[model samples]
Target: MNLKQEMSHSPQTVILHQHPLTVHTCHTVVVGSGAASLNAADTLHRMGQTDIALVTDGMNRGTSRNTGSDKQTYYKQSTSFTDADSPLKMARTLFNGGAMHGDIALVEAALSLKSFYNLVGIGVPFPHDTYGQYVGYQTDHDENSRASSVGPLTSRYMTEKLEAQVRRNGTSLFDRHLVIGIITTPGENGDPAATGLLTINMEAIDDTGYGLTLFNCRNIIYGTGGPASIYHRSVFPKSQAGATGIALEAGAKAHNLTEWQYGIASTKFRWNLSGTYQQVIPRYVSTNANGGDETEFLEDFFQEPTPLLDAIFLKGYQWPFDSRKLLENGSSLVDLLIYIETQVKGRRVFMDFRRNPRCADEQGTLNFDLLGETARQYLTNSQALLPTPIERLKKMNPLAIDLYRTHGIDLEQEYLEIDVCAQHQNGGLAGNHWWESNVKHFFPVGEASGTLGIYRPGGSALNATQVGSYRAAEYICHRYTQPPTTTDTFLAQAEHLVQHRLKLLKNLVVNPEQPSNVLAFQQELQRLMSRSGAFIRSRPALAETLHRFQDELARFPNQIHICHLKELPAVFRVYDMLIAQIACLSAMVAYDERQGDSRGSYLIDHEEGTHRISHQGMHFAFSLDRDFRDQVCETFVKLDPPADSPDTKQTTDAAVAAAKVTHQWVKVRPIPEYTTWFENVWADFRDQKIFDEKRG
Candidate 1:
């Protein structure tokens, strides 16, 4: 884990342990050692840009390397050549996800097949049918079975493969260097141009981590994962420290941050309870604090428990929490049922796989014969009409229970504690066709880039990361090229900025507080964000949360004091989490004011018409050739009056700071100059085969 001191990595990494190195520069620097970063470095090398290097907090620590489940998702166009599957169709469907850009969707679809094959080329073992065609299954928000996977550790497998490729290419890897700031200069067009990054060696060998460096580069590829820790309750591995907040602080415009994905996952083992796991019909139980009166909490929310339990069965496929489902009283209602049991009733809820629910019809036993048609048919077809959920799981994916067993949770005997947890952020640094953020020379790959829409197909993010990484490298090589120069002017400006940041960091140590309880503050931030901004949002609650965060931000100067060099990353992570939360709150404020309707994972309990408003539809010809230019439609966000409203916290700073949250471009996007855009930006990056070699 001490990647800095362990300078013995061959073929790739160059570590500086005892040396007081001040500055190192490269043509491009990929920050974060996830799959995206490895892929980006490799792509740049392929583009004949071998002067690329990667800096990361640590090796073997990232969302991509550490997180997995029963079957991780990999979304791409089926190479099996289905009758209805095409790049254009896939692009249309992906773009149709509200708040996403069409052009980006097209880019994802067009590059998907190549992106997928590229992974296979790098040694990722994706399952294929006997015909040699990749096998896939249907996932959330997709009518087609376009998702493929190689069990739970698909992403981890991908990171391993990519890291090998990166090593083979001998891309310089500087591990344990945490990037704390970016150096921006005035571009030719006067927009912010990111020229360098300010970083600190976290492992400073018993010092205060004073060893800092400014990585000046022609381009900066941000591959850090999403801010999963923004919520107190999250499905991400604790090591994932996303760079979205770093982007925000660097003045990059963020988009659709209010749009996120949340659903049920085991609290102990962080595995999503979807697919066959939900279809097996486990008993949903809630126990009181004293652990006595066990209750099937879903029965109270639904008129009859049968429909609710049936919905739970479908929760396997319908994983992402959707507001539309709740309005239609659909399967997503199961998410709401669980959310209420935990968030409202203040109890612990679990999915017991030992046995099926005690039937209301047969008094004490679940009659499998009387199960819902869908559940019955599925079990019948699988030949898994067993007495217990574990038996059905064994018939289905036995890895479901085995995965938890490895994590110290026996799903068969012990109850699987469940809750509505934050999974992924759909919106990110508002990126363009090439995954370039609004800031010039700064590109985002993986979850740091906002290429997804409100409702995306399950397992699509992995493909997005791959596609974005390749495209960003191509774009940097072609369109946004910068000369390698640490000229006096640029170096002077960068050095000034880095010194400022270092001074600020030093100030924290010089004026120490009562050795601040960093973990307690982090937990408080997560608790507030999950309660106020996760699955459901109330204007009053968000306003209150904003002011509360403002108060917390104001207290930063006095309360934040680092005692050890090892603690620097944790403190900065908490700081980034706050910045990310503020950005999310800002976006939700726009949603509440401009498009005041419940959409995607953003559920605002508005008193009917309390904040009703409309705006011109956001349109873009982002899809290649503007194929989806006509797909624009007026979208709305609405919530019927809640039965009973929660008490609103009153704060003077709430309304003021909430209104003042900076949004560079909330309701706009890059208008691609088609005639020039393709020739100017997409000429080299476009996949000719996707357009039948027509050079689209």
Candidate 2:
């Protein structure tokens, strides 16, 4: 359909076309329709708010499957007699995963058992034992029986249930809609409160052209998923498109943007290529042309003490060097070395299912006992996959069956592949504990908010989405005393912004360039990041890459071409590229300034006796742009030991002594203080005229 025709036929599409010109009466508008957004809408309804509308790209297939299965398993495991885990314990485990940087109150709320029960009440079908006890299973990063899954498709299932609930409550949904920007008003404290949203109805508009729409809402919730798409081969759907970029462009202060996780699944051969098929391989075993080996690269490199290893094993089946312990004990250096070695060896690593007996059994249970039953019914009734039972998948993959049959590997296997995935980006629109962002009336939840702190434990994602949604809705219901009118000034500003974006889009369409010009530069950028920024970072490489990036930014305009008037697609893609650069640069700075040995994902040297060696030290170094120039800074910290205990000093001393390290804090001439250094850096960057040049 033509853009105008499509917009005229659909209510949501029409809203977008008229947004710039129409003065919308403000109501509560949720920007995503995931679990978080649905929960938020539900909360608003419960709190007696009727004028609520949810805007989302569409019902996300991957997320819905994951949530549905996760919810089912969570309920089953929580009520199982074999599982005696408590919410308090779950909360503590989550806090440790985040290195104690996460908010305690938020963690506690997320772990509440009632949250799972609430999901069951909302039409989530959970697994149950013969006695009606809920069945549960273990998953990544979760210490207790917190995860319950029908299959890998739990997310999709949960999303469907939640969507149904939202629909039943009469909460309006704008499907296939993309938010372009946010409207905010200056509040009493100089904070910009979100007043409404500008969106494009992608489904309604023709593929060739689409117009902008305005959505006036009292509160906005951002459950826009993660920025993994910024990387070429993320597990998430490409449809995600990093819409959060638009929010960031609209003046959102995103934190932890630098903390994106690097999982082991990335294909080493095709590291820099987009659309390359990548597998989420287990990390327990390393395979060469010879065969599978049982050596744990991570554990061996860290030279993890038996005590720590024992503690990790006891916690659950999957604990890959507790980041909390590494941070406290100053032994992250060792961890980094191992990861670097594994990557350099050119061998694909798989989680050694042989060591962990529970791995196969768990897979079987998920496949047969849970999803198997459903598949059987479907196949019998509909002749799907032309198979009577899908359980035959176990035999199709020899590695899986061999581990199960020959080795007697059971579902509760002791070891599994545990690698970091770009799970979530916690930094997006700055918000308070109540979910209100810097924008007075705007709120963010899920991966779109930075309130979750640096690291999130498994299952916490579900918790945060549900809790944040409910909390934000509750706050808005009480704080929004009256409906907001579309004032003349607001309409004028919206019109101007819309016109500016339209003009930019038009310019791009009329001036198309060869694809190779843009593709070559993109490939070069990806190659630079893969070698210098992936897995490990060093001083010289970082400095060199930043210099290269500066040059690229200068030439980007000349090298790239745009052939569309809808700037949203091109703008979003560019933003992703920029964010990727920012993430890499941040990692480089952190690695460069950090003097101690590398730990976790960051490694110092590839092999033993190399020029680089992971050092053990009390302080970690990081660099940030303050005034615009990069400045290195250090913060004294301990990772393994709890920060609050009296024995912290003794623990730090012992850890340092074990590593045979000593340091003398000497004051160099004219040492810059933190504030002054930041100011100077910020000023330098601003004066460099880079931002202006890029904008132009």
Please list the C-alpha lDDT of all candidates, in the order they appear: 0.72, 0.47
Over 4 Å off, model 1: 1-21, 205-209, 360-366, 480-482, 509-515, 609-660, 664-696
- Rate residue 182 of model 1 by lDDT: 81
What lDDT tens digits, residue by residue, belong to model 2 across residues 1-696?
Answer: 111111111233222223323233447777776777787877787888867777776666334332221122232125567877654455555544432223433333443556667777876766767898766656555555656654434455567787777777766667766676677667676866677776666644433335456775566777776554444423344345455545654555544343444443323211110000011112245555355554555454334343222222222222222233344333233334335444456454444323221222343232222222433353335323211111222322223333233334342343322222233444444455566665567777866664443345545566667777776776677666567544555555465456544544433323445333444555566556655654455567766876676444433343455544443444435534644454436444554444433333333332321232333332233322121112211111111211243555433222210001111222111111123367766885666432231221
TM-score of each: 0.85, 0.62
* Tens-digit per-residue lDDT, 143-194, candidate 1: 7878999888899899999988888777778888877778887776677888
Candidate 1 clashing pairs? 102-623, 103-622, 103-623, 275-316, 596-637, 597-637, 597-638, 598-638
Weakest 10 consecutive residues, lDDT, candidate 2? Answer: 271-280
